[model samples]
Target: MYPFLRLAKEFYVHRNDPALPLTGTHVSHHLCWPWDLDLWMELNNGRTLTLLDLGRLPLARRVGLIAVMKSQGWGLTMAGVSVRYRRRVRMFDRFHTRSRCIGWDERFIYIEQGMWRGGECCNHALYRAAVTDANGIVTPDRVMRAMGLDVASPPLPGWVSAWIEAEAKRPWPPMAE
Candidate 1:
């Protein structure tokens, strides 16, 4: 069993738009590694807290998020992510992230996530995920069971089909003739 699966109870759901930065403005730089101020605000809650520094919080929170579907027996693996930024964020700012399930198929699940500041949407993103096993292996049936998703049969989305086909044709080396 995953330790995070147990620690998930520590985090409570917070719903409220906290103060954030404006569009085209540069706030505190280097607030965290790998991600700059804007990216941080777009992806995080804008608190001084760092996902990495939070120790068990990250895994717990993520596990909690997954638990929603996992309880339904669905396995999830991040497939693709696309983000759009409309504003910046500064120090001492507070905000909220809203996540919702949009759609799903046998092979994939779709989610829409957003970052809000002061009742305005500063950033939005869509995620494509698939179910996997404890070893990070894709097992459609097992994933569905883990997430508790009910379906008479596996469904395939057109986009997912296209992506899979494209990936299958890609050459091992870019310059390979």
Candidate 2:
């Protein structure tokens, strides 16, 4: 289950945080609860993705994205992601999460996030996100303008652009056996 209660706590705790620029990083802390683990006793690969919401939402709040979303009646959605899991995260373990918007293209915004324990990174992920309304996607430039920021998007990094290109070439519907 999604941690809606924890998400609410994050919102309340960060309500007073100052607004951030597009490239600013939002750092937060979290724990791997018993329920977050798999049969093997480490954090489940799927659950790791869900837990990332706790970090990303707070980052959005700090950057004033939530305010814009609310005022414009827009919703955020994760269109895609590429993630790598490294070290194991055991139950009751504490970790620090770092999340930020790297940049955007015509269709989606890109965010980079990592989970770290001690000085080592346990996971890293890049998310392709989109803002939506009753109609469809609201472009990132328009979304930024709603937050009173300029409409210019920083250039996407080479890796991100390559991923976008790769995804473009990938087949959509799977072939029948």
* Local distance difference test, each candidate: 0.44, 0.90
Alpha-carbon deviation at 31 in model 1, angstroms: 12
Per-model TM-score, in order, reads 0.47, 0.96
lDDT for each residue of candidate 2 in 1-177, tens digit (9 for 90 to 100)? 888988898788777878778779988888899989999999999999988998899998888888889988999999999999999999999998899999988889999999999999999999999999999999888887798877577888899999999999988886777
Best by TM-score: 2
Model 1 stretches with alpha carbons more than 4 Å out: 1-76, 134-142, 145-177
lDDT of 1 by residue, 64-123 (tens): 434544455534456765567686555544555555445555455555555566777766
Model 1 alpha-carbon miss at residue 42, Å: 9.2
TM-score of 2: 0.96
